[model samples]
Target: MCIAYLLMARKNSFLWLLLLSLICTLEYIVYMGAKPAGDFSASAIHIDMLQQVFGSSRASISLVRSYKRSFNGFVAKLTEEEMQQMKGMDGVVSIFPNEKKQLHTRGVLDSGIWPESDSFDDEGFGPPPSKWIGTCQGFSNFTCNNKIIGAKYYRSSGQFRQEDFQSPRDSEGHGTHTASTAAGGLVSMASLMGFGLGTARGGVPSARIAVYKICWSDGCFGADILAAFDDAIADGIQLPLELFHGNEKTDTNISFCCNDGPVLASITNFSPWSLSVAASTIDRDFFTKVQLGDSNVFEGVSINTFELNDMYPLIYGGDARILQQVLVEQI
Candidate 1:
């Protein structure tokens, strides 16, 4: 049986940047011929082919990223005329714009991450699976442990912001949240400002995490996403994704969707190869004790991290506003 996989970026998604034909220069990803035979480096071959097409000096400028890991392709900045020329070249498969895609808060892919987070502890866990052949690509002040087996970042079609870290250390907490949710170790008594306090853990607490920093301050570019995908496939991670479109009720095999908002037709996954997961609500309620001067105590839903040493005057919001106006008039 023959199987074909198509990689497409969603509309307005961070995955790609759509450029108009009227633009003098635009970014595009070109998929070359099949993988080279034994001992042949796909990257080297891609560079050579690029040099042949765009000349030695221009090739260096035009070439943005090389996809050699599992897929045989490369991303380049080319004009419309040059794109046409590349289309007629030998061993060229297909070419398309590096469009952008929208991003959701619940999924993975974000700015760099914090390795020191407690959820990323690698205690009592065995070494990574023997099939894992990935490596940790860390820079100064950044390192990966057994819990985070691999780390890599990509930026091919866009420029990084001033605050953007080139390394895989997440400045924002989104990457950490998604990674921890995927494979973070169990963290006891975890809560946000003493809310929902309980034993916190990920779906697969024992599983290791491999951080791939594709999204940046601006957004996640298609070329970068493709580069990360290629590297991931080469790094021994298998993402058997296939796209399908139909009614969910009729299509029983369409199993994958994100932890998106509770809305109609919000399930994002359509492929049968992917998995369906939902973030269920817990039964826990957080309440703090409120003690009055009369020694009367009551429990209210709130987050109280600090102790109240003394009782304070409590008044309605409207009354407090009126009092503030009166005091301002006297002043």
Candidate 2:
């Protein structure tokens, strides 16, 4: 009887140990399953590290300011000497002709048809031999003459969604032209002819651009412009450290539209800091002649008429005028 009792005791002990082991294994699996997937903390840490290394701290700001002061002083001295020389010379009518620094506010057309080398394979379109379509103003041939610096972001299947806004890339080159006119680094025929050189040199030369490729390939949807504005504002805030140098002033100019219609009401309501500009060809009427022209002639077309087929009338002409008037009043 004693031996049988010992055997039962040992059997019970073994069964208890097995059950505990099973429970521990199940608990571990459940704990692992409940954990989140990707570790965002790691990425955040890297970003912080980058901000520390290459980013401008207060020290960098001081250095930049000192340098700018010295450079400006030198330029001022030279200008003073020039003025003195002119004063001594005869038949010098005046030294200063108002010397007005023209202020230009820029805008973006939220078109969808931006070309990308990566999308070529996805769409079965095949990659172009070279990425650049042409050069505009500054830098070397290889650097400047290529397509827009950040065309990759504008391709189809990018972050832009149709539900958000409907415009894509530039099919009509209107967006590109508008962008170039606003903040393009390159000089075109207009600049060479002294047309848009001074007052038309855009609001900011070195402003960082954040594009929202919401427009369709052919045309733009007003909703897309609104989405672009929202996205741009969000992106600007999220990566403020990455987007602009700490020492440099943030660009307040927001250029959009082509030439001369009323600013988008939604844009004005949302991004008050941004200045919306409509295309202003040398035409007689407000709602007519949306095509880009050089010195009052349609750029590519030989025929000249106030044709609705060629023009982009404001979506709501009355609304556009009201918005334009409001923007004017604000200025």
Clashes of each: 18, 35
In angstroms, the error of model 2 at 4 is 80
RMSD of each: 10.7, 25.1
- lDDT per residue (tens digit) for residues 36-83 in model 1: 666666666767776776566556656777766555688887776678
Each model's TM-score, in the order given?
0.64, 0.27
Best by lDDT: 1
lDDT of 1: 0.69
Pick out the ten consecutive residues of candidate 1 with the lowest summed lDDT.
1-10
TM-score between candidate 2 and the true structure: 0.27
lDDT of 2 by residue, 63-156 (tens): 1010010011000111232334434433222233212111122245344233331111122223332422321222221111122333212222
Q: After superposition, which runs of candidate 1 have C-alpha atoms over 4 Å from their true positions?
A: 1-23, 32-57, 84-94, 105-109, 241-331
